[model samples]
Target: MPGASAPPVERHGRPRNGLRVARVVARDFDGHSETSLDPDLRVFVSDLARPYGLELREDLLRRGVGHSYGEMAEELLAQALPAGEPVDLLILAFSSPDVRPGRSAAVHLSRFCPGAPLAFAVCDQGPAAAFTALRIASDYSRSGACRRAVVLAVEQTSLHHRPAAPVVLPDRHRAVALVCEQTDGDEALVRQSSGAVADSAPAQVRSEWAALGPQAALISGPELALGPQAALSGPEPEREAGLGRDPLGPVVEAGPGQPFTGVWTQLAERLPAWRAERRPVLVADLDRRLGRLSTLALPAGVAP
Candidate 1:
């Protein structure tokens, strides 16, 4: 086990963000191949949908076509979480509804996971929910309420009912788990939420990244792409990837099909390479309908 408490201070010539992410892992699921939902879930969804004059479709109720958050978290944790490693906090963030309804995956995960830490879920805020979870985890460590935290961001493409308006869904089932731990540094990770709305999100994201120089990168979600041109107004990534381009460095975005897990998936895939290059990273995501924007700024070369 790692040290429990470490003051947030600059260490090793690097501005230590309050939280050091020990591990980051993500996976994309092809067609929903999980077992079928039991009778309890079907009854729950059927009653819930009655209010909108919607009934459960036979296809939606079939097996091999849906996902359970609990199941997905289990898989990710198995890959990222070490055996018998105690966790101080566990948070689940998702934009899509899990196949198993009326059950809290976070709480359920706590029971099987080592430490049985405080657990909960954050949702309905779209991509910003993950940032919110990260911010909360950082606050817990800073306040001395926790020693380590795990944040699970999961999104499934299955929506059993029709929406009043068109919604952006992920291309496939995907989930990312971030094991964020306290660093003995005296500084905190940069996290901001609710300031930028749908209209201003792009400008804000661009300005923030523009100041990071070549040792930095910004990975953003599709929600921030609401403006005329969401891509950062800078040179190609090949140039800014330490090749000498705009100060904004490189911009990686979640695609339209992956409205929720896009940015996170990108981060999970590219974190290692960026860490090797010693580049600090920023993740900015938004809940366009809610007009809320959130950003998570990480120090260079975060662990694992």
Candidate 2:
């Protein structure tokens, strides 16, 4: 799991298309030990302006679940990268505050990759930061600035580290790693829309689905709790059943800590299934806190 330092950074031309998706791996840390929201902890968070003490908060923390976000990211990198193969770029996205005073999870993760790939951290946008990271990675890869970029998105319960701001909670700790390379063709694309237009988000997303065709499935992020009526409005109720089902799964919900990384983690797991069904998958993540929407549409066979 150790190698030479990352290569010196280089600049390159901008290719027209986005990155060609490669290996994808995800991990979920759920265990038997459980942590409850005690009264003293509740008192510490009594003045914040976000949803706390929600039903899912207790559900997110389980017994014996122990792993920091950086450790999870390292595990993911080990799974995504081959031995001694250095990554050209590393984009680590997470919402929690850094475990160390001056270091970030990205910095901790860089230890796993021997190369001096231009590693950086993306934050301050919540789960939507993953979309921002992808955009930067795609632009870097397309511009020929680098090759073989790895994106690691991680989220863990704030049971141990409490922040003042609101966060989305999930069933457990999770991380996702996407190994991307430079390629040109019709492939997976990520689209992010800014401004607080929550009302119009559904309609715009519906239009994107129309453009992608009927085979596209809609997976809304935890921040985006769009119902079928709000997300899809057409004559095909039966076809829209996919939207009615839990996009990521029942265990994942938007509430306490950052759940955006779990969105990618879930995508990594189910992408092959979507490809097998011969359908293009569209993921819509709305930053409910920031009124931003990040969407990704990947063509079949990108991962499979």
Candidate 3:
């Protein structure tokens, strides 16, 4: 009998709706030559705080390898929020973490916003990560979990750069934040997929659920390098030439590549057609050489 009827929606303590994006702040290694602390971070944070009527509460520096994505999220959340404040939603994005099986973002988030709804995804590019955070915030708003949600995407791309492979060097490292709220006449995006391929190694899937007035698509997979025919009809290609011998296979194989081309191409082809039908498209490549970083794709022209 317990399964017979729909549970009543909780109203007494539930989060409110119509959350609008309050603010967005981003910091990148735009002019830095090395990993030394960049002083412009304060300026960037200050700029982001202005539109939202908030100020930078703390200057927690995310450097080198001392912290993972989850730790970074925890530190930022602790500084931005006071203890016991009720949060409706939290979204964390990062390139790497201390462990694989245990997602640091979700875990650390639970500590500060105990009962708040949460969602997270990883990407190899900071912009992509920001896009993902925005979408997640929108989803939580639609679900009626919180009136406002906090979204963050941070990266240490310098870790993936190597002098020997100069072509593979990622030019920057950064973190970005956004506070989202619901608004009227705001359209939503929906994500549709058949799920992952059984034999295909893990690959990044950036699907845009909804955006302002139209839908968008951002695809980051390991298959960008493959030709159309090979990507579409070919069998799963063999793993990269040296994957078996490389110790970093786990991280190296995270983005789009030959094996993922089939799916990527399929989506790419279909997404454009969707856009032509009045949907705005925001697509980018989180190239394989960039290694793993959080990625996102937001509604075009939506002020970040």
Candidate 4:
């Protein structure tokens, strides 16, 4: 491990201002056809807005390409604050975006809520994005950059649908939001273990391997309710062999199930290590396809 690269450093320091979650509003495209409004998105937005005494605006609709991060941001902002008050923070969560090269949410925020502080976080698929937004808002509060923040997470898994292949769609689209406010009390969720493990870390290797054993189990789980195994096969023999040297090197690719299984496996094994190390961990599983969305948080009492 001597030459092993250290995990990327997180920006840790006092926040510029006492921050808090004021409100959260999110939307998804669920129960709606590819050409219709994703009902799940509307429900998500409604849930967050209602709790905070807000309502969804007609202008704020899910639109644009399936990759609608910018569109979602604009819609959420419009619905959350119809009167257009100056916002302190804005966080957008999405699985995909219209543009790959630029941060679509940031771009949209710049145009819609230009003066507000902005942050973006992605999650594992869509449901997880809501959680990611909460964490991002919490980080902002901890940083003291803002007093109130808006968080939105949306996902569209429909793109993965392939008629030729046996597909497992779990209500396909979901969106959620949270409003975070700075608090002097204890954190709602303690940060446990954070920092990225190298794609070569032993922990990472064990996780990927353990995942192979349970991939079938996940596909068969009643919660996920995926049907018979599709024609999809495991990774090529040559690729599978290469994984040992670089376990995180992206071998053994399959559907979403494989990567998710690997991450849960990693968390199950690593969380205990973190606890043994005296860290209170919160596991964040992000989109493997998007990369680096996963995070672990060790709470205040935990050791560095």
Over all chains combined, what TM-score does candidate 1 have? 0.79
Order the candidates by lDDT, highest first.
Answer: 1, 2, 4, 3
Q: Least accurate stretch of 10 residues (summed lDDT) in model 2?
A: 1-10
Residue 70 displacement in candidate 3 (angstroms):
2.9
**Residues 76-127 of candidate 2: C-alpha lDDT, one tens digit per residue:** 6777775757778899887653323334557667777858688888888866
Best by lDDT: 1
Deviating ranges (above 4 Å) for candidate 1: 1-17, 30-35, 62-64, 186-190, 214-247, 301-304
How does candidate 3 fare on TM-score? Answer: 0.39
| TM-score of each candidate structure, all chains considered together | 0.79, 0.68, 0.39, 0.40
lDDT of 1 by residue, 1-304 (tens): 0112233445465543356776688887766644445666677777878888875666777653677888888878878776767888999998888888677889999987778899999997777677778877776676666777899999887777666677776778888898887776423354454633656655666665544444333433211112112333446663344212334445565667777777777778777776666576767766756667666665564333
Off by over 4 Å in 2: 1-17, 30-66, 159-166, 214-258, 301-304
What local distance difference test score does each model get?
0.67, 0.57, 0.38, 0.40
Sorted on TM-score, best first, the list reads 1, 2, 4, 3
RMSD of each: 7.1, 9.3, 15.3, 14.2
